[model samples]
Target: MDGWHDAADRFGVPRTDAVLLALNLYGLQTRLGARVRLQVSVPVGAQARTIVIAAGRPDSPFTLADSGQLFAGAELVGAAVRTDVDDAVSGYLRCWDGTAWRAATINPASRSKCTGCAPCPTSLEPTADPRLDTEDELHLLLDGLRQQLPHGGSLRDLHEITVSTACYESEDAALEAMMVLRKVLRSRRIDARIVLLSSVVRSREAFRWLAEHVGPFGLFLTADCVTRRNLILKKTKADLLPELMPALLADAREAGLDTSFTYIVGLDSTKDMEPFLSAMLPQVTLFPSLQVFQAHTPVMDGLHTPEADEFSYFLNARRIVESVMVDAANNLVPEPWRCYRSLWYESYAGQPLEGPRR
Candidate 1:
């Protein structure tokens, strides 16, 4: 019998309009390894309709046994059907309507949920002392570097300026911080890149603004995991990730900006052990920068404390990630190993100097 499946194969079906089919008894028993009973629905005017064709049950091949149309109107094509049966049925079949297949109505609520809304400011005022802004610290750091340079000096020559910030409660404050940094860098003629770490499901407007202004500079997204569950648990809005991330990265790349992903290891139970290793190991193609979780200076409360030996896990995970990069190089994946140095906590922050230089 002809059904949606046959039509789908004949004409490449879009996932948005695809309907699944299963034979009530024969197919269920064969596939699921159990005696099963089920019911299915079809359009009212479908051709080649077949009902239960049991030998002893009835003479007529097809019958309208149930009351009310299982589904109605042009919008019922991919709509799901619910049914129940007392015992296992013998078999089932589906028929296709002659004209174009029915189209299901899109739920407005579902569409809205999928489409992200504009980000609202969480608070009117800055949560921390405005005087304690990191921008000041950054300016001072740059000034210190300048003192060490020759008469005709530049910070661009020494260390590449890599700026990063945590996603606090307010997006307004974050933007403000970014703007301040941008102004300072431009004024000082410093060649620097900004990495905005946001836990929020960013609004399209925010992304557009970032692209238009900071698109030329580098941008990196920092997330706890690639999955939604872990993201939600970390107080991050999951709807924006994976999909949003790729879009942002694409835009940045097209704009000739450096794009990267930063992930902290040992963040969750799922992100530990084999699953974590497997998830991160193969992502070398993605060129992810890695950071290990430090037990001291906890970023979030109630995180699983890593054991002393777990340092080995971090090292091993790094090696695996590098190995995947090696494979990519061997396979000749274009732009394999971008050569961006991965930084560890101690190295980036620097080890405490035991004594002053003589």
Candidate 2:
């Protein structure tokens, strides 16, 4: 109850009946035996307020104001939400498209380890159209992205593009969409680097296919936590992520693609930064393009506000990563564009560290 009001207050809107109904409907649909999060906030580049509903347990209370303090952790679950919070919050109670959970069961209360081989559903369903599939939606998305650019440049003038989905239907479907997008962009002489944000790249073949098909593309893999308990909290089957990520990166490298690992700090249950960093920094050095993101609890994810200490943990972790990089190598060129605190290596004085060439 307090969490609900906090969300409303953070959004600077009254807790009207309409908002309550939207939140309740979203909660019920994604409940699925675990607590569903109802995030009420205004998104960037939008006029009206928005409510994003996703499946997960809220371990803490979070508000719109806490966005800056949010750290990425293993408990993060991507959502497929129905747009609500317009005059009438329509499509509020839409069920999980079963896309995000195709790799694992939608359960956060489980105590056992996931098999890691949960079969992904075969049927490719489009929860969000145009951008998720269809050439028309892609164009619309491009138009929207272009509108945000300064001086109003077209898609061809853009240097980079990130194509993401709540959950990719499959590797094949993702490849197909990429191919279509590539063809369209090529026709216009638009050769922007395309980055993919999806969950279907666990297989070696998927990595190979991405390397072969997508031109100047990269995959964003978020390793929120290394512990099994945190992985369970995030409702992910990636328990072996720490072990498998190296192999995955090797596969991507072999295929001539860049794979960037994103680490989120400040999970409620996670306190120590050293263990996570100790295990992770080596990989960061290997990849050299690793990203570290701050975490916040989204109301829709049913997560709690990060503790004050959690944010501090994130700050300290960032400092430590930078320090480690400096010690490990001499030349640490800052890549603020990659991430605010990211370092792009030019050369290690003698070792010759190679950053992402593309």
lDDT values, one for every candidate: 0.35, 0.39
lDDT of 1 at 246: 55
lDDT of 1 at 231: 31
Residue-wise C-alpha lDDT for candidate 2, range 148-262, written one tens digit per residue: 4445334454555555332444567667767777766676687876666554566777767766776776765555445443433333425435656656655665677766565
RMSD of each: 27.5, 13.7
Provide the lDDT at 145 for model 1: 46
TM-score leader: 2
Residue 265 of model 2: what lDDT? 40
What tens digits encode model 1's per-residue C-alpha lDDT throughout 1-358? 2343454344333211122121110121112111112233344332212222111112111222234233211233321132222121111111112321111111111111121211111121112212224556656645654555455644554223333333344556655666666677777875455555454424555555655665444555554445434333334434444445556555545555555566545444334433543433332223455544322211222343343133334434444554454654522121111211122211111122121100
TM-score, structure 2 vs. true: 0.50
Cα miss at 256, model 1 (Å)? Answer: 3.9
lDDT of 1 at 77: 32
Which pairs clash in model 1? none
